[model samples]
Target: MHQTPSRARSASHARPLPWRGLALAVGAAAALILAGQARAQDSGEVTKSHGYNFFGELKYPADYAHFDYVNPDAPKGGEIALAAQGTFDSLNPYSRKGRAAVLSSTIYESLMDGNAPADEYGSMYCVLCESLEYDEGKTYVIFHMRDDVTFSDGTPLTAHDVVFTHNLFLEQGLPSYAIAVKKRITNAEALDDYTVRFDFADDISRRSLIDQVGSTPVFSQKWFEETGARLDEPRLETSPGSGPYTIEDFEVNRRIVYARNPDYWGKDLPVNIGRHNFDRIRVEYFADETAAFEAFKAGEYTFREEGNSRLWATSYDFPAAQRGYVVKEELPDGAPPSNSGFVFNLGREALKDKRVREALALAYNFEWTNESLQYGLFDQRNSFIQGTPLEATGAPSAEEKAFMETLPVEVPDEVMNGEVRMAHTSDSARLNDRRNLRTAMKLLDEAGWTVGADGKRRNANGELLTIEIPVNSSGAAVLESVIETFVQNMQLMGVDAKMEKVDPSQYTNRERDRDYDILFDAYRVFLGVGTGLRQVFGSAEAEFSLFNPAGLASPLVDAIIDKALETSTQADQDTSLRVLDRALRNEFFIVPAWYKANHWVAYWDMYSHPEEIAPYDLGYLDYWWYDAEKAEQLRAAGALR
Candidate 1:
């Protein structure tokens, strides 16, 4: 479905957008026209913020509503040196979209901060609203807005704003987060200027918890109305917000400057209690990844948490890494990376045969991909709950067994059903090849495929077995190499496979329409675990056009996701989710690909942090910073010159 034009799903979050997103195109144009020679704050070299210097993650606002996740607890904040690659429009939090939408919120903020898996990782700490209580038998969740909270424009932040933004997003049907928000809220009413109450219709066990605490970010009711633009407009500027940083200067297709909110209302509130400690946070934009990376090396920006490993190995050797200031340390005990894999679009007719699908999964050499192209940089996620607290890792605790029994999810029936767990047989390629070939041969034989004279499998029409995989143009050259290996592996198994290198525009259109036979691309889901997995593998979700590869959703699997979403307890949800995942695994719904184990990144050693260089909880950008003195020193050392 063609989604709305909002710059982001929720102005507060940057759920990954389509590669080469239109929002990115706009942000780039905005960044270029806006650049000018840096001014020394119209004063001499500046230093220190009162008696405290801040560091760690900082904000780089794209607009009033969209902000990048640059942590706040870094070192002494100063003129922020950051870059962007797209337009910084659509600052309103409720209707923002894409990367710039992320930039906007880091400059601004909301009522609560929710970073991850809500079952435990998500906790709603009040930002503008300090105390929240569920009254009227938990039928209505009441929020007490902090009296001191005010928008950057000096208007009081009130309950009306929260209610209005909630309703606004609901009306817009934005992607990335619309369905997530729609599930919980029946009604959001502005009870009064300071107190707002939410009324719900379902027996939502965590109703107050998820809504008031989980993912919903409140916006300024007055500021939005005053701005007089639709929330998703690309021309969005003059965004009214009361964040730790206020928009000091903004150019449509250029850079944005945010001065520290001298009157940041929630500076002492619970969510803002010990964060947002920078004198300024800025976000600039560029056109391409190459431009942005080059600029970072030129000392124009400070950090990049990335996918480009070649550069990290080669680039950071800039003189900065030699000094103590430009420290580079590989973090220890970081959370496991979210699994990145190709989700089979089971909507097509030919892929309906689960046997053919399983055959494809056995063909991918994940070990080879990880070792050669990635230098063993990523981890292989064997389970659905990658990085989640209760993933089926190591072994189950007594607490886990007790937790599993109460929920409606399934425990793998490997022992009972005589099913081979993919995990067990996939430890090595030779073993996988033998096991996978056996499995593939059995499935294909059952599907009416006959063996030819040469011992190659053939369909009913006697054509050599073949499956077409589409590779898009943007990264087609690398994908061509990856697919070439895959084709060779398939050929080794007596299957014919060919790569269709097509324009990304054409490929993406076909993908959205579910028009390809076999495809290679990552279905990158954030928060690797949560309820409603049916959205990805459910039969009913199938009609909603969700990905149910092999079209193999039985009644049991569909019921599990439904129960998990409706259940009151996290344990209950986990049990159901585990069952759902087990069902998916048994069906072989996806050919698993590689995952990132580490966010291999580098800054010119000039980057500084308030906290020591550390990895963030989950994959959120909490362990990044910017340095002005070191940045200037790098500049003085002729890095930029």
Candidate 2:
């Protein structure tokens, strides 16, 4: 998953390509010569490239037409109504402040569009850029400006605008993006009126160079100067963008309406030929997902990607669903599974011991949860990169063993012997497995916790063993059940564990501040490795309060992640990733959770989509179109009222 600021953050909103990991061998001279020849053919003064792939070669040719996942002749006229989980206060997505609207990215266009095919991995196609140019070394990237591009305000897009946007993100964006740019990108310069070049630091990898440059969205320099708006503050005014849509109307914290740009410059581009098919995209924000579901059932929204497994299994028995006015579809998922579960905050002294953490993890009964709550629609996610070749399985290869030898700490024998220790206990029949409970109790006793006469375990200081879990409203239903079961098993082992369902905003703020004992969280691991991964397990990120939610800090883990990112060959990447996965699993910072294999979605009968969806995304915003005739038919039948 190659994350771009212009891309959406979740599956339910405007779809963005995952900022996946990259792997490719480089051949310098021949690559530079070919790029120069291609560019020379396009323009006399400079060479240009249409796109780049992180893997070996580009699948689509130089003169390729529209993407295969779209209907070229799809008509666009009607509107599509969608639902958002929480309230949105800001329109400026670059800032780390308020939650931006769901489809906010639709208004902005990037130098390259990251809508890639299944096999391409981290490939990015030219969108705002007519062509791209870079040496095989990947020290710098040159974007050949499309002369015909213009913002919604009718201002011409130029190299200066690109430079300005890059600087804004570097100075005042999310700490993750800011830190990445400051370290990887050296400078951005305008070569001419129609060309911009992004110079990369020598330490940057080939994959990181392309992803960072191509995914950057160019903002109008003139608009910012005139408005005098702070880039770090949340503003009501929509930033002028050159994408297919613009803010038609908006009511703060309620609903946002976007109208397609009649003067959109890139509509006919090969990358966007059949995309952005809706005339209007309206995103309605609700306080909670339950209210949003009820609104969806009442036809307040036209489409929904269901996240609740229980609702998908038994809740859709309404008149619209029974009458076939609404449709339900299950699409295959190709991306990696989420590592969501009860994560221990290592900042707490009580959870600092590996034995205690391991004992707590063993008490969670995922098998029972899958059978009762989820309808057996999920599988346990064991590794960080679940459902991928990068995942560590079976035993460590000779390469992985060699890498582990260099580390200061010894790799666990169970991991080295290819024995995977699942978080669940052995007994599938009982919620509180007595065998697993005894094991947990023995481990706790060894870790200096003894059961008191009151049946509560306590340390030498008489401090009870307690774990606090803070959860948001969206996860309340799913987590409440899991928490109840986990607490039951923990009580048998003389441990006190409780979960508090907090408001959405309170939960987000507490998470950002890193103020909790145990929290239900999920982290997505991509296919490739890079410095961006530091946010999850790196010691430096722990200090910055970024993605290291568990407060994990280990020299061995850092070294493994660094080695994986630094490796160039496919074989080397495989070895380093496995070693890292094995090392992290041994730590037991998070009690692994279950993940669904497919996307469960329901939509109104008034919409249509392309036959093939992008492997990494649903492509609803990009490929799905509103059928006005169908909408009228449903309206006449009083099914859509």
Candidate 3:
């Protein structure tokens, strides 16, 4: 399955302030003034900087079309390209799901961005909106846009664009659009050109507000009104946008060319002053990942970012590595790969019982699977969101302790009784699944689901336990095999469990529609904790129609989710999130899986990495310039590997 590389395209509107003091003068000036000269004269290669590096060949240049090297007037050019494994045609962030798609949407956007750190999973930074202001209760939020901000077309951006985008989230009836927008934002009114206020019927937080609002891409009022597009058919919608790069050219399943807008309004915004470095970004498409990789070896794309660990270790160093065209780079800061595991569809009817979920969690053997298919290339994880206040890190803060003690939310005996039952990524002391299975077995037995004569779990009604893992193989494949191994182990233990892989496109729909038992690798969440996990197991977000990926239902978990939303302070929010995490862990709702530290990447080295740690690869995109002379040197020496 040849795939097209993608980036996130948040459809929100935001603004940046005066950048005189931010030390962005050099970066901002470089992007605006010497962009062409920089691209034309870039040379030298340094492997490590802050925590991000890339050298993979671009397979799909059609969708991700580059015009910088060839012609600043022809199309925009980008340095990074992925050997996409499959054709996930959707590029719009609103419609896209997996990591590649989501990240690609960001690349194609001018709003929000994620940092590619030297040592972490990374966090998102705001681009368009200045700072989201949350009310004391967290229900209402105010977004203040910079007066000078303008769309890619050079039209001054206003609060109207922000309100318009949210309204579209409702009008288009985007799946998560309602959960993130409609439920809380009862009313949206632009105070003036620079300010927009959202009135929430209920309480929600501000940290979450910008993500919902600022993260969305803003459109030109003129373009939208002229197109008469209501987003009913996103495939056909071509509304104008205001970003560093505008769609100079785009073709479905072929290529997308973005040129740096000469008159880009927010070019010098405080948040985006140093980003969107490429003169243009060109993405070309291919049939499947295998062919795409072959093309990468042929220098068609950059190289490869093996999403599957087995392939990361095995597939590389093939005939291609013999040449100097490919090189495997180990991460100096953290593990070489990213987190991978199953996301139990809490929205499914089969996932309703907390014990059922815990019992299912025991079925997979992370240790065995790690040794078998993964070859110890990945780490396991119990928390849904990694590296955020929302993560269920052990040793609760003072506020969290009190919240857990008072809130009707019950912390399991494992959490409250002498032992803390903490979660660790790859604890040498204790294996990831070892502790998980113990809890799983205990939770199931306590829930009254007994092992049957046939060695399969049966409810009182005599129905055998079966888990339907919805799979399409869009991004990661580790979970599918993990689920299979788990099912086999469960059978040996007198339990009936099996892995069911389905179409990737239909998997989310089936899970979202509340139509599946257990969807293996349900989603690769977009942001760290910025994206509220309320819909997955949240009472309201548990519906198939809503944002509920996991169909878990519990009054206790729901209350904690609500309480978490009620606070506006980051410190208190962290405390609330911890309270919510411990409460859900006690319920045994989600069968925590594995976590990958970084994208296990192997690419042809060319471009120079940052001098220090670049906060994120995309965040510092503007700071990166291709070295033509060095690129030619590597090309001649075959040092690209």
Candidate achieving the largest lDDT: 2
- lDDT (Cα atoms) of all candidates against the true structure: 0.50, 0.75, 0.49
lDDT of 1 at 336: 38
Residue 298 lDDT in candidate 1: 60
lDDT at 360, model 3: 65
CA RMSD for every model? 12.2, 4.0, 11.2
Candidate 2 vs 3: which has more lDDT:
2
- Better TM-score candidate (2, 3): 2
The TM-score values for the models, in the order shown, are 0.71, 0.91, 0.71
Candidates ranked by TM-score: 2, 3, 1
Model 1, range 393-489, lDDT digits (tens) per residue? 4344454445445545554545123332444234343323566666766777787666787867687787776667777654423346657777666
lDDT per residue as tens, model 3, 241-320: 66666666656655555567777765554344334556655555565445666677777666354556776777777654
lDDT of 2 at 398: 80
Worst 10 residues of 1 by lDDT: 48-57
lDDT of 2 by residue, 1-641 (tens): 33344212443555554444354222332342223234322233433467775433555667778777678898977888888776677787666566666677667777887554433555567888888877656677888888999999999999989998888877767776677567878889999978999888885455466766677777889999888887777778877899999999988878999999989998898888778898998888787777888999999988888877888888898889999999999988776766787888999998999899888877887887777877777788888877777778777888888877776666567766675554554566667777778888999999999999999999999999998777777543766777878877887889987777787667767887778888878665656766656666778766554466788888878878766766766678767877777778877889888888887889999988877666677777777888888889999999877
Residue 29, candidate 1: C-alpha displacement in angstroms: 52
